[model samples]
Target: MSIVVIGSLNMDMVVRTKRAPEAGETLFGQEFALSPGGKGANQAVAAARLGAEVTMIGRVGKDSFGSGLLEVMKQEQVHTGYISQSESQSTGVASIVLDEEGENRIIVVPGANVEMKPADIEALESVIRQAGIVVMQLETDLNMVEAAAAIASRHGIPVILNPAPAQPLGDELLHQVTYLTPNETEAGILAGIPVESVDDAERAARILLQKGVQHIIVTLGSKGALIVNASGSLHVPGFPVQAVDTVAAGDSFNGALAWQLTRGKTLDEAVRFANAVGALAVGKAGAIPSLPRLQEVKQFLQEAAEAEPGAQ
Candidate 1:
């Protein structure tokens, strides 16, 4: 089975500090680094590292960042044939700040990500058609997301829409999504409720379900996830890990979820695997650099199961 990711490519500029600075206040930072990251690219790399045949469909600027982004994708074995170059826009970038606790604050500059036109989506029709699953994020143009989802829905492919950078979505897109993966904050905005706990997350998921989403998964960092569908809801518990950086934790979960589904795992099973992937991702620093390989996840799960004696 194969997965197609319709999203963005970016070079992340990251800074580390003891604590996040208040607005307009400058603080001394512990470190600074550059990483290839974008919600779409992160998901693609996460899936590829976990042994999935993944293809990325997006655009990048004609610059060094774009070149580096493509090279990293290739190194991760994510197919880059569908990635395009933007003549008018620079590659997208994200400014990220990580604190001592590994929490992050991000500001995104969409750049070439939003510059991708409808024609780009149209050009990838055939590629999307053959995919077992189609994954998308909100970093790219809204039209691109809808266009890809429409095609995937038409082909009977399951679509996993990770609604990051939370925004309201119409029913047409919601109805086409097989699974809507949103973190607590994103879910709250879509559902018009403040999500403060697992129970609150479920309430938000239920509200979104009425908006025509087939199933909704509300991701709770370190607390696991809440899945609500027409029939019922379930909570997939998270694994314990000392978080080094929470960046890409949600992206890793989405990627692992898609890969496990391709292998015929049940949604419940898939979410469990996804949780493990997310745990591992937060244990390391950086975005793409932190995603674990397939074997690592399996071993992590095995050890988890041994410790919990089937509770895993």
Candidate 2:
């Protein structure tokens, strides 16, 4: 089955610092690195590396960064036939600062990503029609995201919306989403509740459900994730790992979850698998480079199981 990712494509510039800068103040960083990372591209690469057939639908500029982004997609085996290039705009970019503790702060410049319009999604109707699942994030224009969700809904294809960099959404968009995955902070913003614990996440998820989203998964960082639906709420624990950089952990989780769901795994199984993927990603340092391959994930899971008590 094919997965379509309709989102942004950006080059990430990361700075490793001892701590984030205060307002009106600056601090020297220890190191700097550049990598292919937009929420869309990162998720697409994560899924592709985990053996999913992924198609990326976004816009990039006709620049070196754009070229490098496309090259990364090709190397990851993600289909880039639907990706467009704009002559008027530069490629999108995210400037990120990571602290010694692995926490990060980011600022994104949409650039070419904002150039994606409903027309672009309409142009890829055939690709969306053939996809088993369509994954999206907030890096692109919200109008385009809504249009894509509507189109996928009309075609009866499942849509997984990860509300990253969370913003207010309308009922029309919420009604079209089959699954809504939001991290704690995002869920808190969308639901207008404090998502500090599993109970809080459940409450936030319930608010989303009332807004017409069918299923909700609120990721709780190291604590795990909360799964909520009409049936009830369930908490899936996260895998413990030493985090080096948390740049793409959430993206990896979303991608792996989508891939597992497409493979007919239950929500519990998918979340568990996604947790492993996220754990692996945070243990590394880059965005796309941190995503684990299918074999690596399987081996990691096997090792974790063996390390558990009372294993034969």
TM match of model 2 to true structure: 0.98
Q: Where does model 2 exceed 4 Å of error?
A: none
Candidate 2 contains a number of clashing pairs equal to 0
Predicted candidate 1, C-alpha RMSD: 1.4
In terms of lDDT, the poorest run of 10 residues in model 1 is 303-312
Whole-model lDDT for model 1 versus the true structure? 0.93
lDDT string for model 1 (1-312, tens) is 999999989899999999999989989999999999999999999999989999999999999999999999999999999898998999999999999999999999999999876777977789999999999999989987888888889989999999988999988999899999999999999999998988888999988898888989888888888889998999999998999999999999999999999999999999999999999999999999999998999899888888986573
lDDT of each: 0.93, 0.93
